[model samples]
Target: MHVQNKKRFYLMVGLLIVVILLVGFSIYMIWSDISSSNAPVQTASNTTNTANADSSQGNRTDITASQAITNPTDLLVLVNKTTSLDENYQPSDLVWVDLPGVRETQLRKEAATALEDLFAAAELKNLSLYCCSGYRSYQTQEELYAENVKTYGQKEADLVSAKPGQSEHQTGLAMDVTAESVNFDLLESFGQTTEGEFIKNNAHLYGFIIRYPEDKTAITGYAYEPWHLRYVGKDVAAEIDKNNLTFEEYLKTS
Candidate 1:
Protein backbone atom coordinates (compact mmCIF):
# COMPACT_ATOMS: atom_id res chain seq x y z
CA MET A 1 0.00 0.00 0.00
CA HIS A 2 2.85 2.39 0.81
CA VAL A 3 4.68 1.75 -2.48
CA GLN A 4 1.42 2.24 -4.39
CA ASN A 5 0.78 5.56 -2.66
CA LYS A 6 4.30 6.80 -3.49
CA LYS A 7 3.80 5.82 -7.15
CA ARG A 8 0.46 7.71 -7.28
CA PHE A 9 2.05 10.82 -5.72
CA TYR A 10 4.89 10.73 -8.26
CA LEU A 11 2.36 10.41 -11.11
CA MET A 12 0.34 13.39 -9.79
CA VAL A 13 3.50 15.56 -9.53
CA GLY A 14 4.52 14.56 -13.08
CA LEU A 15 1.04 15.53 -14.37
CA LEU A 16 1.23 18.90 -12.61
CA ILE A 17 4.67 19.59 -14.08
CA VAL A 18 3.41 18.76 -17.55
CA VAL A 19 0.41 21.08 -17.08
CA ILE A 20 2.66 23.96 -15.96
CA LEU A 21 4.99 23.46 -18.91
CA LEU A 22 2.00 23.37 -21.33
CA VAL A 23 0.57 26.57 -19.83
CA GLY A 24 3.93 28.35 -20.03
CA PHE A 25 4.37 27.28 -23.65
CA SER A 26 0.86 28.51 -24.54
CA ILE A 27 1.56 31.87 -22.91
CA TYR A 28 4.81 32.22 -24.80
CA MET A 29 3.07 31.42 -28.09
CA ILE A 30 0.35 33.99 -27.40
CA TRP A 31 2.96 36.59 -26.54
CA SER A 32 4.90 35.83 -29.72
CA ASP A 33 1.74 36.24 -31.84
CA ILE A 34 0.90 39.54 -30.19
CA SER A 35 4.42 40.85 -30.76
CA SER A 36 4.25 39.82 -34.40
CA SER A 37 0.89 41.52 -34.83
CA ASN A 38 2.19 44.77 -33.37
CA ALA A 39 5.25 44.89 -35.62
CA PRO A 40 5.20 47.36 -38.53
CA VAL A 41 4.56 45.92 -41.96
CA GLN A 42 6.81 46.75 -44.88
CA THR A 43 5.67 46.79 -48.48
CA ALA A 44 6.79 48.08 -51.87
CA SER A 45 3.91 50.55 -51.92
CA ASN A 46 5.52 52.54 -49.09
CA THR A 47 6.98 55.22 -51.38
CA THR A 48 7.61 57.65 -48.53
CA ASN A 49 10.03 55.23 -46.90
CA THR A 50 11.82 54.43 -50.14
CA ALA A 51 11.91 58.04 -51.49
CA ASN A 52 13.82 59.39 -48.47
CA ALA A 53 11.17 62.00 -47.76
CA ASP A 54 13.11 63.34 -44.78
CA SER A 55 16.17 64.09 -46.85
CA SER A 56 13.99 65.75 -49.47
CA GLN A 57 12.34 67.89 -46.79
CA GLY A 58 15.61 68.98 -45.20
CA ASN A 59 17.62 69.79 -48.32
CA ARG A 60 15.23 70.21 -51.21
CA THR A 61 18.00 71.25 -53.56
CA ASP A 62 20.63 68.88 -52.28
CA ILE A 63 20.50 65.40 -53.78
CA THR A 64 22.52 62.58 -52.30
CA ALA A 65 25.09 61.38 -54.83
CA SER A 66 25.03 57.75 -55.93
CA GLN A 67 21.70 57.20 -54.21
CA ALA A 68 20.10 54.10 -55.68
CA ILE A 69 16.46 54.73 -56.46
CA THR A 70 14.22 52.17 -54.71
CA ASN A 71 11.27 52.84 -56.99
CA PRO A 72 12.86 52.49 -60.40
CA THR A 73 9.60 51.86 -62.25
CA ASP A 74 7.68 54.71 -60.65
CA LEU A 75 6.91 57.66 -62.95
CA LEU A 76 8.16 59.95 -60.17
CA VAL A 77 11.48 58.15 -59.78
CA LEU A 78 14.12 60.80 -59.38
CA VAL A 79 17.19 60.39 -61.57
CA ASN A 80 19.87 63.01 -61.67
CA LYS A 81 23.51 63.62 -60.77
CA THR A 82 22.58 62.55 -57.23
CA THR A 83 20.34 59.54 -57.92
CA SER A 84 21.14 56.69 -60.32
CA LEU A 85 19.17 53.86 -61.81
CA ASP A 86 20.57 50.35 -61.74
CA GLU A 87 22.79 49.53 -64.71
CA ASN A 88 20.50 46.61 -65.52
CA TYR A 89 17.28 48.57 -65.10
CA GLN A 90 15.20 48.80 -68.27
CA PRO A 91 11.57 49.72 -68.77
CA SER A 92 9.53 46.61 -69.50
CA ASP A 93 6.78 48.53 -71.27
CA LEU A 94 8.83 50.38 -73.87
CA VAL A 95 7.08 50.72 -77.21
CA TRP A 96 8.39 52.00 -80.50
CA VAL A 97 7.40 55.64 -80.76
CA ASP A 98 5.20 55.96 -83.81
CA LEU A 99 5.71 59.66 -84.32
CA PRO A 100 7.72 62.14 -86.37
CA GLY A 101 11.21 62.02 -84.87
CA VAL A 102 14.79 62.75 -85.85
CA ARG A 103 15.44 59.03 -85.50
CA GLU A 104 13.50 55.92 -84.65
CA THR A 105 13.18 55.48 -80.89
CA GLN A 106 10.99 54.13 -78.13
CA LEU A 107 9.28 55.42 -75.02
CA ARG A 108 7.35 53.85 -72.18
CA LYS A 109 3.83 53.12 -73.39
CA GLU A 110 2.19 55.74 -71.18
CA ALA A 111 4.71 58.41 -72.11
CA ALA A 112 4.34 57.53 -75.75
CA THR A 113 0.60 58.06 -75.53
CA ALA A 114 1.09 61.40 -73.81
CA LEU A 115 3.62 62.42 -76.44
CA GLU A 116 1.10 61.60 -79.15
CA ASP A 117 -1.49 63.78 -77.50
CA LEU A 118 1.04 66.60 -77.10
CA PHE A 119 2.10 66.40 -80.71
CA ALA A 120 -1.49 66.33 -81.89
CA ALA A 121 -2.25 69.40 -79.84
CA ALA A 122 0.74 71.22 -81.33
CA GLU A 123 -0.39 70.30 -84.83
CA LEU A 124 -3.72 71.94 -84.12
CA LYS A 125 -1.83 75.18 -83.42
CA ASN A 126 0.21 74.82 -86.66
CA LEU A 127 3.36 74.22 -84.63
CA SER A 128 5.49 71.63 -86.40
CA LEU A 129 7.17 69.75 -83.56
CA TYR A 130 9.51 66.80 -83.85
CA CYS A 131 10.79 64.24 -81.39
CA CYS A 132 14.58 64.35 -81.42
CA SER A 133 15.33 61.65 -78.88
CA GLY A 134 13.34 59.40 -76.60
CA TYR A 135 14.30 56.36 -74.53
CA ARG A 136 17.98 55.45 -74.41
CA SER A 137 19.34 52.20 -73.03
CA TYR A 138 22.11 52.32 -70.45
CA GLN A 139 24.58 51.15 -73.09
CA THR A 140 23.40 53.82 -75.52
CA GLN A 141 23.74 56.53 -72.89
CA GLU A 142 27.22 55.25 -72.02
CA GLU A 143 28.24 55.48 -75.65
CA LEU A 144 26.73 58.93 -76.01
CA TYR A 145 28.48 60.14 -72.86
CA ALA A 146 31.80 58.77 -74.09
CA GLU A 147 31.36 60.44 -77.47
CA ASN A 148 30.44 63.74 -75.85
CA VAL A 149 33.55 63.55 -73.65
CA LYS A 150 35.68 62.80 -76.69
CA THR A 151 34.15 65.56 -78.85
CA TYR A 152 33.54 68.40 -76.41
CA GLY A 153 35.90 67.56 -73.49
CA GLN A 154 34.85 66.31 -70.06
CA LYS A 155 33.63 69.56 -68.53
CA GLU A 156 31.26 70.41 -71.36
CA ALA A 157 30.19 66.77 -71.64
CA ASP A 158 29.33 66.65 -67.97
CA LEU A 159 27.04 69.64 -68.41
CA VAL A 160 25.41 68.25 -71.56
CA SER A 161 25.29 64.50 -71.03
CA ALA A 162 24.30 62.43 -68.02
CA LYS A 163 26.54 59.60 -66.86
CA PRO A 164 24.97 56.39 -68.22
CA GLY A 165 22.83 55.20 -65.31
CA GLN A 166 21.96 58.75 -64.30
CA SER A 167 20.11 59.57 -67.51
CA GLU A 168 16.30 60.01 -67.30
CA HIS A 169 16.11 58.56 -70.81
CA GLN A 170 16.63 55.15 -69.28
CA THR A 171 13.31 55.58 -67.48
CA GLY A 172 11.60 55.83 -70.90
CA LEU A 173 9.73 58.88 -69.65
CA ALA A 174 11.83 61.71 -71.14
CA MET A 175 11.81 62.96 -74.71
CA ASP A 176 13.91 65.56 -76.43
CA VAL A 177 11.73 67.69 -78.67
CA THR A 178 12.76 69.79 -81.62
CA ALA A 179 11.27 71.73 -84.51
CA GLU A 180 12.29 73.07 -87.93
CA SER A 181 13.15 76.27 -86.10
CA VAL A 182 16.06 74.39 -84.49
CA ASN A 183 16.57 72.25 -87.58
CA PHE A 184 15.78 69.13 -85.52
CA ASP A 185 18.65 69.74 -83.09
CA LEU A 186 18.53 69.46 -79.33
CA LEU A 187 19.79 72.97 -78.71
CA GLU A 188 19.10 75.70 -76.17
CA SER A 189 18.13 77.87 -79.11
CA PHE A 190 15.00 75.73 -79.33
CA GLY A 191 13.74 77.59 -76.27
CA GLN A 192 13.43 80.82 -78.24
CA THR A 193 11.41 79.41 -81.12
CA THR A 194 7.63 79.52 -81.41
CA GLU A 195 7.61 75.74 -81.13
CA GLY A 196 9.62 75.95 -77.93
CA GLU A 197 7.29 78.61 -76.54
CA PHE A 198 4.32 76.41 -77.33
CA ILE A 199 5.93 73.45 -75.58
CA LYS A 200 6.76 75.54 -72.52
CA ASN A 201 3.20 76.81 -72.28
CA ASN A 202 1.27 73.67 -73.21
CA ALA A 203 3.43 70.65 -72.32
CA HIS A 204 2.11 70.45 -68.77
CA LEU A 205 -1.41 70.31 -70.17
CA TYR A 206 -0.49 66.91 -71.62
CA GLY A 207 1.33 65.59 -68.53
CA PHE A 208 4.86 66.70 -69.52
CA ILE A 209 7.20 69.23 -67.97
CA ILE A 210 10.16 71.11 -69.38
CA ARG A 211 12.40 69.17 -67.01
CA TYR A 212 15.36 71.54 -67.00
CA PRO A 213 13.95 75.03 -67.10
CA GLU A 214 16.31 77.91 -67.92
CA ASP A 215 16.01 79.40 -64.44
CA LYS A 216 16.49 76.18 -62.44
CA THR A 217 19.95 75.17 -63.71
CA ALA A 218 21.45 75.40 -60.24
CA ILE A 219 18.83 73.09 -58.74
CA THR A 220 18.72 70.63 -61.66
CA GLY A 221 22.50 70.16 -61.91
CA TYR A 222 22.29 70.44 -65.68
CA ALA A 223 22.16 73.03 -68.41
CA TYR A 224 18.77 74.47 -69.30
CA GLU A 225 17.54 71.72 -71.58
CA PRO A 226 14.38 73.35 -72.90
CA TRP A 227 14.01 70.54 -75.41
CA HIS A 228 13.86 67.87 -72.75
CA LEU A 229 10.37 67.02 -71.54
CA ARG A 230 9.64 64.60 -68.69
CA TYR A 231 6.32 62.87 -68.14
CA VAL A 232 5.10 63.09 -64.55
CA GLY A 233 1.37 62.52 -65.20
CA LYS A 234 -1.12 65.34 -65.80
CA ASP A 235 -1.92 66.24 -62.19
CA VAL A 236 1.71 66.46 -61.14
CA ALA A 237 2.55 68.36 -64.29
CA ALA A 238 -0.21 70.89 -63.55
CA GLU A 239 0.97 71.35 -59.98
CA ILE A 240 4.54 71.83 -61.15
CA ASP A 241 3.41 74.35 -63.75
CA LYS A 242 1.20 76.28 -61.33
CA ASN A 243 3.98 76.43 -58.76
CA ASN A 244 6.77 76.94 -61.36
CA LEU A 245 8.75 74.20 -59.62
CA THR A 246 11.33 71.79 -60.89
CA PHE A 247 10.77 68.08 -60.46
CA GLU A 248 13.14 68.04 -57.50
CA GLU A 249 11.38 70.95 -55.84
CA TYR A 250 7.96 69.49 -56.48
CA LEU A 251 8.98 66.16 -55.02
CA LYS A 252 10.63 67.79 -52.03
CA THR A 253 7.55 69.79 -51.10
CA SER A 254 5.23 66.91 -51.89
Candidate 2:
Protein backbone atom coordinates (compact mmCIF):
# COMPACT_ATOMS: atom_id res chain seq x y z
CA MET A 1 0.00 0.00 0.00
CA HIS A 2 2.88 2.46 0.75
CA VAL A 3 4.64 1.68 -2.59
CA GLN A 4 1.40 2.22 -4.53
CA ASN A 5 0.84 5.60 -2.86
CA LYS A 6 4.44 6.68 -3.63
CA LYS A 7 4.04 5.63 -7.29
CA ARG A 8 0.81 7.65 -7.61
CA PHE A 9 2.50 10.74 -6.16
CA TYR A 10 5.38 10.48 -8.61
CA LEU A 11 2.96 10.22 -11.54
CA MET A 12 1.16 13.40 -10.42
CA VAL A 13 4.49 15.24 -10.07
CA GLY A 14 5.53 14.30 -13.65
CA LEU A 15 2.16 15.50 -15.08
CA LEU A 16 2.50 18.85 -13.26
CA ILE A 17 6.03 19.35 -14.71
CA VAL A 18 4.81 18.56 -18.23
CA VAL A 19 1.89 21.02 -17.95
CA ILE A 20 4.23 23.77 -16.68
CA LEU A 21 6.60 23.21 -19.58
CA LEU A 22 3.75 23.43 -22.14
CA VAL A 23 2.42 26.63 -20.52
CA GLY A 24 5.88 28.20 -20.60
CA PHE A 25 6.37 27.34 -24.32
CA SER A 26 2.97 28.84 -25.19
CA ILE A 27 3.83 32.07 -23.33
CA TYR A 28 7.19 32.34 -25.10
CA MET A 29 5.63 31.78 -28.55
CA ILE A 30 2.99 34.45 -27.97
CA TRP A 31 5.66 36.94 -26.81
CA SER A 32 7.87 36.22 -29.80
CA ASP A 33 4.97 36.75 -32.24
CA ILE A 34 4.03 40.03 -30.61
CA SER A 35 7.67 41.25 -30.79
CA SER A 36 7.98 40.32 -34.48
CA SER A 37 4.79 42.27 -35.34
CA ASN A 38 5.95 45.34 -33.46
CA ALA A 39 9.36 45.41 -35.15
CA PRO A 40 7.92 46.15 -38.66
CA VAL A 41 5.79 48.98 -37.29
CA GLN A 42 8.81 50.57 -35.67
CA THR A 43 10.88 50.29 -38.87
CA ALA A 44 8.06 51.78 -41.00
CA SER A 45 7.68 54.74 -38.69
CA ASN A 46 11.43 55.51 -38.81
CA THR A 47 11.50 55.29 -42.61
CA THR A 48 8.58 57.71 -42.95
CA ASN A 49 10.27 60.22 -40.67
CA THR A 50 13.52 60.01 -42.63
CA ALA A 51 11.77 60.60 -45.93
CA ASN A 52 9.98 63.70 -44.65
CA ALA A 53 13.23 65.09 -43.28
CA ASP A 54 15.03 64.51 -46.55
CA SER A 55 12.32 66.25 -48.59
CA SER A 56 12.33 69.28 -46.31
CA GLN A 57 16.12 69.56 -46.42
CA GLY A 58 16.38 69.27 -50.21
CA ASN A 59 14.13 72.14 -51.28
CA ARG A 60 13.90 75.59 -49.75
CA THR A 61 11.39 76.92 -52.27
CA ASP A 62 7.74 75.89 -52.28
CA ILE A 63 7.80 74.57 -55.83
CA THR A 64 4.51 72.74 -55.92
CA ALA A 65 2.32 73.15 -59.06
CA SER A 66 -0.37 75.04 -57.15
CA GLN A 67 2.05 77.81 -56.11
CA ALA A 68 2.76 78.80 -59.72
CA ILE A 69 0.15 81.52 -60.09
CA THR A 70 -1.35 83.48 -57.26
CA ASN A 71 -3.71 85.71 -59.19
CA PRO A 72 -6.67 84.24 -61.10
CA THR A 73 -7.58 87.61 -62.63
CA ASP A 74 -4.25 87.71 -64.42
CA LEU A 75 -5.19 84.67 -66.45
CA LEU A 76 -8.48 86.27 -67.41
CA VAL A 77 -6.62 89.33 -68.62
CA LEU A 78 -4.33 87.23 -70.77
CA VAL A 79 -7.15 85.27 -72.42
CA ASN A 80 -9.57 88.21 -72.89
CA LYS A 81 -7.05 90.47 -74.60
CA THR A 82 -6.80 90.67 -78.38
CA THR A 83 -3.54 90.31 -80.29
CA SER A 84 -2.23 92.65 -82.99
CA LEU A 85 -0.16 91.97 -86.08
CA ASP A 86 2.56 94.57 -85.54
CA GLU A 87 3.25 93.27 -82.07
CA ASN A 88 3.48 89.53 -82.81
CA TYR A 89 3.08 88.99 -86.53
CA GLN A 90 5.34 89.50 -89.56
CA PRO A 91 5.60 92.86 -91.45
CA SER A 92 5.29 94.97 -88.36
CA ASP A 93 2.59 97.62 -88.04
CA LEU A 94 2.88 101.07 -86.48
CA VAL A 95 2.79 101.09 -82.68
CA TRP A 96 -0.19 103.39 -81.96
CA VAL A 97 -2.71 102.41 -84.65
CA ASP A 98 -4.76 99.82 -82.75
CA LEU A 99 -7.65 100.76 -80.38
CA PRO A 100 -6.62 98.16 -77.80
CA GLY A 101 -2.95 98.69 -77.07
CA VAL A 102 -0.45 95.86 -77.01
CA ARG A 103 0.80 94.39 -73.74
CA GLU A 104 3.56 96.99 -73.63
CA THR A 105 0.89 99.65 -73.59
CA GLN A 106 -0.50 98.43 -70.29
CA LEU A 107 2.76 97.39 -68.68
CA ARG A 108 3.74 99.32 -65.59
CA LYS A 109 5.48 102.55 -66.55
CA GLU A 110 8.32 101.10 -64.52
CA ALA A 111 8.58 98.40 -67.17
CA ALA A 112 9.60 100.88 -69.81
CA THR A 113 12.03 102.42 -67.39
CA ALA A 114 13.36 98.95 -66.72
CA LEU A 115 13.88 98.48 -70.47
CA GLU A 116 15.93 101.62 -70.54
CA ASP A 117 17.94 100.27 -67.64
CA LEU A 118 18.34 96.99 -69.47
CA PHE A 119 19.61 98.76 -72.54
CA ALA A 120 22.03 100.74 -70.46
CA ALA A 121 23.27 97.56 -68.82
CA ALA A 122 23.62 95.86 -72.16
CA GLU A 123 25.57 98.78 -73.55
CA LEU A 124 28.25 98.21 -70.93
CA LYS A 125 28.90 94.76 -72.37
CA ASN A 126 28.59 95.89 -76.02
CA LEU A 127 25.42 93.75 -76.24
CA SER A 128 22.59 95.68 -77.79
CA LEU A 129 19.03 94.65 -76.89
CA TYR A 130 16.39 96.53 -78.86
CA CYS A 131 12.59 96.29 -78.95
CA CYS A 132 11.68 95.42 -82.51
CA SER A 133 7.99 94.96 -81.80
CA GLY A 134 5.99 96.45 -78.91
CA TYR A 135 2.25 96.96 -79.55
CA ARG A 136 -0.21 96.14 -82.38
CA SER A 137 -3.77 96.78 -83.54
CA TYR A 138 -6.58 94.37 -84.53
CA GLN A 139 -6.61 95.80 -88.07
CA THR A 140 -2.89 95.31 -88.25
CA GLN A 141 -3.36 91.74 -87.08
CA GLU A 142 -5.89 91.10 -89.87
CA GLU A 143 -3.58 92.48 -92.52
CA LEU A 144 -0.67 90.48 -91.18
CA TYR A 145 -2.73 87.30 -91.16
CA ALA A 146 -3.87 87.85 -94.74
CA GLU A 147 -0.29 88.35 -95.81
CA ASN A 148 0.95 85.29 -93.94
CA VAL A 149 -1.72 83.06 -95.49
CA LYS A 150 -0.79 84.38 -98.93
CA THR A 151 2.92 83.86 -98.41
CA TYR A 152 3.29 80.75 -96.19
CA GLY A 153 -0.08 78.98 -96.56
CA GLN A 154 -2.75 78.86 -93.82
CA LYS A 155 -1.24 75.98 -91.82
CA GLU A 156 2.33 77.29 -91.71
CA ALA A 157 1.33 80.87 -90.96
CA ASP A 158 -1.04 79.75 -88.21
CA LEU A 159 1.82 77.93 -86.55
CA VAL A 160 3.77 81.17 -86.09
CA SER A 161 1.06 83.83 -85.70
CA ALA A 162 -2.21 83.72 -83.85
CA LYS A 163 -5.42 84.77 -85.60
CA PRO A 164 -6.85 88.21 -84.87
CA GLY A 165 -8.30 88.63 -81.36
CA GLN A 166 -6.55 85.52 -80.06
CA SER A 167 -3.09 86.95 -79.48
CA GLU A 168 -1.39 87.78 -76.15
CA HIS A 169 0.37 90.79 -77.69
CA GLN A 170 -2.74 92.99 -77.47
CA THR A 171 -2.33 93.19 -73.71
CA GLY A 172 0.48 95.72 -74.15
CA LEU A 173 2.36 93.63 -71.61
CA ALA A 174 4.61 91.69 -73.98
CA MET A 175 7.73 92.66 -75.90
CA ASP A 176 9.94 91.20 -78.60
CA VAL A 177 13.55 91.97 -77.81
CA THR A 178 16.50 91.31 -80.09
CA ALA A 179 20.26 91.60 -79.97
CA GLU A 180 21.96 94.21 -82.16
CA SER A 181 22.87 92.06 -85.14
CA VAL A 182 19.76 89.89 -84.84
CA ASN A 183 17.28 92.69 -84.43
CA PHE A 184 13.63 91.47 -84.83
CA ASP A 185 14.94 88.01 -85.73
CA LEU A 186 14.40 86.45 -82.30
CA LEU A 187 12.82 83.33 -83.81
CA GLU A 188 15.97 82.24 -85.60
CA SER A 189 18.45 83.02 -82.81
CA PHE A 190 16.93 81.32 -79.77
CA GLY A 191 19.40 79.31 -77.58
CA GLN A 192 22.22 80.00 -80.08
CA THR A 193 24.04 82.97 -78.54
CA THR A 194 25.10 84.21 -75.14
CA GLU A 195 22.68 87.14 -75.28
CA GLY A 196 19.72 84.83 -75.90
CA GLU A 197 20.66 82.66 -72.93
CA PHE A 198 21.12 85.74 -70.76
CA ILE A 199 17.66 87.03 -71.57
CA LYS A 200 16.09 83.59 -71.11
CA ASN A 201 17.67 83.08 -67.70
CA ASN A 202 17.41 86.59 -66.24
CA ALA A 203 14.23 88.03 -67.71
CA HIS A 204 12.21 86.89 -64.70
CA LEU A 205 14.12 89.30 -62.49
CA TYR A 206 12.51 92.14 -64.45
CA GLY A 207 8.98 90.68 -64.27
CA PHE A 208 9.24 89.19 -67.74
CA ILE A 209 8.94 85.55 -68.87
CA ILE A 210 9.64 83.78 -72.13
CA ARG A 211 6.04 83.42 -73.36
CA TYR A 212 6.71 80.28 -75.34
CA PRO A 213 9.53 78.20 -73.95
CA GLU A 214 10.93 75.26 -75.92
CA ASP A 215 9.72 72.49 -73.64
CA LYS A 216 6.19 73.95 -73.50
CA THR A 217 5.38 74.08 -77.19
CA ALA A 218 2.29 71.94 -76.79
CA ILE A 219 0.76 74.21 -74.18
CA THR A 220 1.57 77.59 -75.82
CA GLY A 221 0.56 76.44 -79.34
CA TYR A 222 3.68 78.10 -80.66
CA ALA A 223 7.31 77.27 -81.08
CA TYR A 224 9.91 78.58 -78.65
CA GLU A 225 10.62 82.28 -78.76
CA PRO A 226 13.46 83.26 -76.46
CA TRP A 227 13.10 86.93 -77.27
CA HIS A 228 9.41 87.17 -76.48
CA LEU A 229 8.89 88.29 -72.90
CA ARG A 230 5.56 88.79 -71.15
CA TYR A 231 5.18 91.03 -68.13
CA VAL A 232 3.16 89.51 -65.27
CA GLY A 233 4.80 91.44 -62.40
CA LYS A 234 7.85 90.41 -60.43
CA ASP A 235 6.28 88.15 -57.82
CA VAL A 236 4.28 86.10 -60.29
CA ALA A 237 7.24 85.80 -62.63
CA ALA A 238 9.41 84.55 -59.80
CA GLU A 239 6.88 81.89 -58.87
CA ILE A 240 6.50 80.76 -62.46
CA ASP A 241 10.23 80.53 -62.90
CA LYS A 242 10.75 78.55 -59.72
CA ASN A 243 8.00 76.08 -60.54
CA ASN A 244 9.08 75.64 -64.17
CA LEU A 245 5.52 75.78 -65.47
CA THR A 246 3.94 77.33 -68.57
CA PHE A 247 1.29 79.98 -68.19
CA GLU A 248 -1.35 77.45 -69.22
CA GLU A 249 -0.19 74.95 -66.63
CA TYR A 250 -0.14 77.67 -64.01
CA LEU A 251 -3.68 78.62 -64.96
CA LYS A 252 -4.96 75.06 -64.66
CA THR A 253 -3.58 74.67 -61.18
CA SER A 254 -4.60 78.10 -59.95
TM-score leader? 1
Q: Which regions of candidate 1 are displaced past 4 Å?
A: 1-68
Question: Which pairs of residues have clashing backbones in candidate 2?
Answer: 102-171, 102-172, 103-171, 103-172, 103-173, 104-172, 104-173
**TM-score of each model, in listed order:** 0.74, 0.58
lDDT of each: 0.87, 0.60
lDDT of 1 by residue, 1-254 (tens): 35668878999999999999999999999999999999998777777675676334322322332232566777777999988888899988899999998899899998999999999999999888888889998999999999999999999999889999999999999999999888788889999999999999999999999999987878998899999999988988998999999998887777
In model 2, what lDDT does residue 115 have? 55
Could you give candidate 2's per-residue lDDT for residues 44-158 as a string of tens digits?
8778997675444312233333332222113223432222223333221223322122223333244455555655665677766667566455566678878989999988887
Off by over 4 Å in 2: 1-76, 80-110
Instruction: Name the TM-score of candidate 2.
Output: 0.58
